[model samples]
Target: MKHKRSLLALPYVGWMALFVVAPIVMVVVYAFTTAGFEPTASNFTGMGTYVSIFARSFQLALIATVICLLIGYPISYVMAKEGPGFQRVATVLIMLPMWVNFLLRTYSWMAILENNGLLNQLFDAIGLFDLINGLFGTDLTYFRMIRTQGAVVLGMVYNYLPFMILPIYSVILKLDRSLLEAAQDLGANSAYVFRRVIFPLSLPGVLSGVTMVFVPSVSTFAISRLLGGGTHMMLGDLIEQQFLGGAYNPHLGSAIALVMMLIVIVCMWVMNRFGQGEEQAVVL
Candidate 1:
């Protein structure tokens, strides 16, 4: 009775069961099936599809995840250091964009990154635009960062920043300040205190942030679509393409999706390990 009660404890678990787990099972079954409703393969013919995913889509996701983590860490730290009032204000400011539609925000980025955009106007005002025009001559648009890897990264950071910041900030806010004080009183310098005390204390936040940003950013398709000129297809975009009939190979697509999921799960495990490692470093 106790075990049964524990199993059914989560109401939201039903949603997870229906949506997340069910879809995953569907993909798994579909991955080994060929088109035209054939029952030839049985979860064993997706090796080629899985291989392509590793070679292309996985690389794209890894780059995007790295970009998010690199840019989000410092911003999260600053927000965490602020007082409660300020933290709330910053949170509101940071989260304000999330209240708006994601597609709208992506469109906004396109507006600024397109040719004859606001950024080019600012650059021209500063004479840098003309300087680039003189330097590159026929490649002003490319120089200005439109439809490139940089643009894709920019879009990812914009959408996922709040995800990274919120988790890290929550952990940092609850961190004990006494540890830093103790380190300082023991004649440790500022750098030492930060390296030995503050950073270790904030590891939980850091790990949470890394996991939060890394997983979704890796699998995200929209940023690459709008900013990457369709050439920088991430795993999300590839999976999405299959579902939306662009690829027309849903079987192959499911294999790609499952492989991407495995990568994310491994990353999540690694992130949790880092958090535990950080905890071990703390004196208490």
Candidate 2:
């Protein structure tokens, strides 16, 4: 039985080590090495790349994460506590947008945010046109949504909301009914119970959701390119630039990839440590 079990596990272990561990280890090492695969002890280059990614890449991600949290929390809470039928409907509604091409969804924001776009038309109709137009009128501007930070957040939220919802819903679904009942019986109101009990127990799901949204939002290129336009750029776009743009530098791209991994790791650690609630981490 033991031998057979080991045999069964062999392929799984091998594949993980090969694809997951190997690639990460290689990237981490290469991020520290000199370019052109000619291994060197040039730690200076790696540190410099790391510093650059920290300052720029993380700033965009921070903005996107804040946007998702401000928007997703109430929505997730509603779905999690609502009737089953309503939850199902909300699940579909939230996921439906994700079914479309990510690039298309991002580009669609352009039409909404562009100069002379739907937003401007609506603003003009509502008598706020002069205020908006006077603020920073420019024929070539794309500020309503496109070529702006808001557009990028919109795209990231649209694409990654499911990530936030699914995990949170999973945990909230399995929340201990008795504890909530006990809290209510013990003279606790809804808000107090939630603030003290329910939200506390749901830390794991919150962590997972935050991680899912923040990690991808930080690295996504399509949203930035399509919505934020050429003016606003994320690390993923920077990585693409290193390889595909005029400044084709694979080594730099790889270095950026390594930095991304580290950022994700650090974020996960922070969530696990500081962001977690006092109560035990709940599971779905």
Candidate 3:
């Protein structure tokens, strides 16, 4: 019976081989081969130009990840402590933005943040910009809010925030209230209880949320492209331009893809280490 049940997984294994394994093999081959199918190091030899792009990408993603954590953790905590009706309404509201297509959401931001768009118009109507300009005695009318690095980071946080919230919320909801009560009975204050009890148990969820938000934030091209106005180039943009842009260099594109994969793998390893620490804390 065990042997028969094991055989049931053969189709899934075969699917992975065909879809996952084969594509990775092709990418590896392309990364190392020239257009004529000959081995060449030219693809990697040209990585000097991409160093700044990689650094900028990492910086932007890190900013977005940290912002998500700071914003999401508190919201998740509140949601977890709420009644069923409140949680239901809050969950729907939190996830409502995701019902729209991601590209559409991004485009909507473009409209909101554009120089002549709703935000600037609202500022003009409210006389806030005029007040600032008058106070400073400058002729400034509209600040350049869109097409900047900050805009890109804002887009990332907005889009990926729910990924952070959901995991932490799930973990917080499962927390043993009895432990919290016990700590309080022992004269522990709210801050002390959170510091000693609640936070340690929530590490797993924090790690999971970091993984979910960071991985996608690091590789995202669309947000950077649309929000940064193509001035900010990340690893994803480099890979995209290599393959689909004017260059048409599959070898270089594959190399960039491999590098992105390695970065994500490193992030996962770091998250795993944190998870192990969480387990140790639980044991203690």
Candidate 4:
């Protein structure tokens, strides 16, 4: 039986070795080597020039993650507390945008947020711009909503908000009802019960949602490119430029990727630890 089980696992092991392990190994090798295949650390050393890009990526990602949490948590909690029919309809609505292609969804946002796009056209039709100009005594045509950092963050939020919602919803929906009843029996009010019992138990889901949202937001290129119009270049775009753009430097790209991976790993570790601590405190 043991030998048979080992044989059964061979294909899975081989798959990981070929796909996951091999790519990671290649990235590590390229990250530590020069274009000539000679070992060198210059690639990492040169990263000083892109500090602002890294900062902006993390900042925008953090903002988007926070927005998703603020918006998703309440919705998730409500869904968890609602009837089956309501939950079903809410779930479908939340997931409807995801059924469309990601690029198409982003393109739709472009049409909505562009200077002379649908939003501005609506504003013009409604005399909103005219009202603002009249009050301010200034001539105004359209608001510059696209091609800014705010637009990039908005794209990230729209694209990744569902990721934050589903995890938290699943977790909240699965909470033990007996515990909530016990808290109530102990004279805990709704707000107290949530803060003391519900929120603590939901830490794992929150952490998962944060990880899901933050990772992609931090590494996104297309959203920043299309929405930000190359003005707010992120780490993902910077890495792409090194390998595929005019820069043509795979070594530097690999180094940046490796550093980003390490940073994400550390962040996840910290979040997990914090979640565990919160859970432990709740249990006590």
lDDT leader: 4
Question: Arrange candidates by lDDT, highest first: which order?
Answer: 4, 3, 2, 1
Residue range 152-192, candidate 2, lDDT tens digits: 77777778878887887878778989999999999999998
lDDT of 4: 0.94
Candidate 3 colliding pairs, count: 0
Cα lDDT for residue 125, candidate 3: 93
Per-candidate RMSD, Å: 3.4, 3.8, 1.8, 1.2
Error of 2 at 25 (Å): 3.8
Model 4 Cα lDDT, one tens digit per residue, 1-284: 99999999999999999999999999999999999999999999989999999899989999999999999999899999999999999999999999999999999999999899999999999999899999999899999999999999999999999999999999999999999999999999999999998998888889999999999999999999999999999999999999899999999999999999998899889888888887887768
Query: Distance (Å) between predicted and true CA of 42, model 1?
Result: 8.4
lDDT of 3 at 77: 92
**lDDT value, residue 102 of candidate 1:** 96
Give the number of colliding residue pairs in candidate 1.
0
lDDT of each: 0.75, 0.76, 0.90, 0.94
Clashing pairs in 2: 113-145
**Which window of 10 residues has the lowest lDDT sum in candidate 1?**
42-51
Q: Residue-wise lDDT of candidate 3 within 167-273, one digit each (tens)?
A: 99999999999999999999999999888888888878888898888888988999999999999988778888888899899998998888879888987897788
Best TM-score among the predictions, by candidate number = 4
lDDT score for residue 203 of model 3: 79
How many collisions per candidate?
0, 1, 0, 0
